[model samples]
Target: MKKLVVLLSLTVILSACSAQASTNKDSNKDDKEKVSQSSEKKQTSSDVYVPNPQLTDDRSLLEIGQAFKDDKGVSSLKAIKKVNETYRIGDVELIIHDVKVIEHTPSYSMIDYFHGFTHEETFDFVKANIEIKNTSDQPVYFSPIAILESSTGEHRDWEADIYLEELNGELAANGSKKGNVGFILDHSDKEVEWVKIFTSDLLNEEQKVTNKAQEITIEF
Candidate 1:
């Protein structure tokens, strides 16, 4: 009888130890699952790249070479990228980009109050952030870039533009960087409806041909 009693106690102890071990394993699994979930949430929050949208088809920037035709100011066709889908029509080369239309807006700062307002204007300025990927092997300098508006098809005509005046940014060959590109949208010119942008240095001179040249619609 004593032997049977001892055997029963041994069996109970073995079963109890197994139950405790199983409980510990289950607890550890739950802790690991919670930690995994927390880590996943943090990783998701880190991956947001919100680029400005108004960079689509910047016609004005494309025309920087045309508006200011001097060799120095003219953005060389050699310097622009191939993704722009352009061909040489005469001596002019068209540079293009896909811009996100983020703000078709009016100047709402204290600066706008110097004149007077009539109504909520139809976007006088366009602003966008662009990712400039330098596909060339050499680096190039930039001017306070101008935003150009395209008149359809491939033509480098300077449209409504807002000159940045001081654009001395650098780009690494085969590397990528991001910067802002914009245009002065004129409420008066219907040609300024949609825009294209290009960057250039001011030391470059403009080729003088009048028609689609920049007109002072609004000075900001």
Candidate 2:
């Protein structure tokens, strides 16, 4: 009888050990699956692109540009020009921080926006980092680049701006805005040597022009 009891106890201990081991194995698998799902979710979120991101920080803009380039397989052969030039038209101040030309082949998701500007699968565009400030004590209407003319004789109006940060229109008193403005070039492969920016006339609350428009040029 004692021998039978010993054998039964050994069997029960083995079964318990086996059950614990199986539970541990199942738990590890669940943990791994959860981790994989989380990773996939993060990757999917990052893959979504925003063309007209409302961002003011320069670093964020650079990251967004990098993400766009990566997503669209874009490239740039020319070096970026750093033009830290500032122009003051009456109470409004405009600053151009940098400019670069990029060749982009929009992905299928981005075709809608690019189709409005170009029919080609691949094209080149110019992007400029800029800042505008209303330095007066009252509100005013202004546009940093009402017209953008390239040295290659290509002209683009404010309506063609792809960045669309709302940098144009009314600015509050002593308020400032900083962001990027981009335009698709007509000649996709042409080299741009310089660009001339025509700013809109400063207007008062009555919508009357209080200050004349200004023309500024930047060399690349």
Q: TM-score of the candidate numbered 1?
A: 0.30
Give per-candidate clash totals: 25, 0
lDDT of 2 by residue, 154-195 (tens): 888777887765566666566655667888888766778888
lDDT of 1 by residue, 5-37 (tens): 343333323323333434444335434434444
Off by over 4 Å in 2: 1-68, 77-79
Give the per-residue Cα lDDT of candidate 1 at 147.
Answer: 28
In model 1, the runs with Cα more than 4 Å from the true position are 1-97, 100-122, 127-129, 135-138, 143-168, 189-220
Clashes of 2: 0
| Best prediction by lDDT | 2
Alpha carbon lDDT of each predicted model = 0.30, 0.62
For each of the candidates, the C-alpha root-mean-square deviation to the true structure, in angstroms, is: 29.8, 27.5
Worst 10 residues of 1 by lDDT: 210-219
